[model samples]
Target: MTDKAHVVIVGGGLAGLLLGCVVATTCRDRLSVTLIERALPEAPEESLDTRATAISRGSKALLDHWMLWEAVSNEAKPIEDIHVSRAARFGSAMLRDAQDAREPMGWVVENVLLQQVLVARCEAEGVALLEGREVVDFCATQENPKLTLNNEEVIDADLVVIADGAQSALRESIGIGAIRHSPSQFAIAVNCETDGADCGVAYERFTSEGPLALLPIPNGSSSRARYNVIWCAHKVKQAALLKLSDDDFIGALQAEFGWRAGKILRVGRRTGWPLGKIAARELVRARCVLFGNAAHTLHPVAGQGFNLSLRDVERLATVIATEAGQDAPFSSVERLSVFTDMSRKDHEQTMGATSQLAEMLDSPSPFVDGLASLALSTLDLTGPIKRNVAEFGMGRR
Candidate 1:
């Protein structure tokens, strides 16, 4: 009886939550949105993820487009410059936001805070939030796709957006499989205090063992700046690193990261996970689609995962709003395929860049260090190439 198409989004992570917000805010007249989150509000304190994320300028624009930027910006710290260099190497690249002095290349935010802001936006926009639940299975029919909830509730929808994490059971229910890259690796993430003051600068320093990323995050009332550290390497090295005492870990970090952030004064508890490239073989089938880690999981070396997914969500919302005025909705198999095609170039470019960086990070060859150094130093001096790189990094292009 209703003209508005129903859109059921599975997973309340960043991707799904943002998708629900965009669709509900932009297409409220044309669509009804529902979001399913498996985790309940009473999640244990340890269950709340404190990891930080770097979002590009392009992503900020998308958030602004949906009127959610103000809330996010309040909690975000800007990245004015990104320093890329290999430890004890001759070459380095410094990329900055040259287009507008008022704008930054990117912003860093805490993951849990971002999710909270997104959930609030979804609720304000009238999105149905089904917390503490999940989609048990997908009924993928050609005309009307549907989702069966864990509570045995069946909801029919015109489109299903799967934004679950990498291990998505619903994605598998639809016969979608993910491919993991070879040569296993791991990354250790931690929060630490540095001896330097906060200048809104980020660093990517490559070393003999692997690439070290030190991203600035907000630290409360501390005299020295704080950072989120990601040290990636082979599993053997990762295990050895994780076993070190906090002081030993700080010492090890100070040795590899150098005096860039001054000294590694203090460190919080460290957490790590095995790293590998994972991507869905196909993104869309009939009335269903995949987004976020479900579609492609990239190394955080480049910090492109969430930003890339945000663009897709924004564009899809636009398409939904535009097509809602038509006699038929935009959730048809052919139309969804077209949407996937439109996003192909970005996904390919980002995934390729992240993979290559990760491979270089884990390479045992001494020559890779020199190659990476030379590439970074050379890319810095080339005006057009550097501009293009800056544009790509900021997601402005």
Candidate 2:
């Protein structure tokens, strides 16, 4: 039994790793942290993470504060402008960084690279990262929380954080139910080469099928521009699109996305998964708390999923640090309540905005289409609306 408050994070994904790094660095003397991940963190040089994430400006600042931003800065592509339009629609809007000062709106980086950098930083901070271990059972109380791993290892902790993802067994075992909503959508993701120059522009084009986002990425030594494509489609169309050859898929994409960003010269391998919104009914339970996908999983329409999670990490870390500074135990109900109170508004707003945008945009009714077009046109003409949208997208508000 250690004198320090022990924290056991039950997941090694980006959110879990980030929380570990934050707490370990912020309250190292007062808190002992352990991260139990089923699989070890991948080596930095391993295969690139097929997925890419939009790191909002707020998230960037948090990463910078942790001293992890510089490590991945070279690979991150800044988005100077974002163009939003609907296919064959009369309304379109473009948000520029200049409108809200000259700061870049956000950055896009490969998932694997970010995780690798964070893992390295956590280890450097003396976080105990236990790989290939999973919690088979969990027992929580006001004073102590316990976990039983598959290897029959029973570990005790003062606090437990569940970030194991949407299908989180730990969250379920703790009697926390998730409110799930499936929009009958699937997102296809892939990397592609474009003929356009690297101008730090991103596109969010909506079509009859669903929303399509083309985010810029660091081209490195290559002269040609490159982008990561996220195209959401209904299940029926998704199956057909996934079966098409590379050339046919490119043709379909070009037809729907138009030639705004130049022609799609070549496309890399494509992968996809089902799209849905999953939010845990309760974010806090006694000495246990849910983080990241365990708390809420939103549609990728606005790229708010990871950004919201990063904000959660920042707030939770602040709460823990404040308590530790005062020599208060983090697992106490009072401290945990403070953490929840601080984060509730941000979580609710993010979840509400993301889900509402997804639902409104995906509606097939003509009334909805007309309303969306009007909204886009209004946003373009209204400075306050545009600024608010930009700020929200950048995770500033």
What value of lDDT does candidate 2 attain over all alpha carbons? 0.84
- lDDT scores in order: 0.81, 0.84
Model 2 lDDT tens row, 31-112:
8889999995453332222567899899999889888899998889999999999998879999975644766899999887
After best superposition, candidate 2 residue 137: deviation in angstroms? 2.4
Q: Model 1 RMSD to the real structure?
A: 2.6
Runs in model 2 with CA error above 4 Å? 40-49, 141-143, 325-328
Residue 39, model 1: lDDT of 82
TM-score of each: 0.92, 0.93
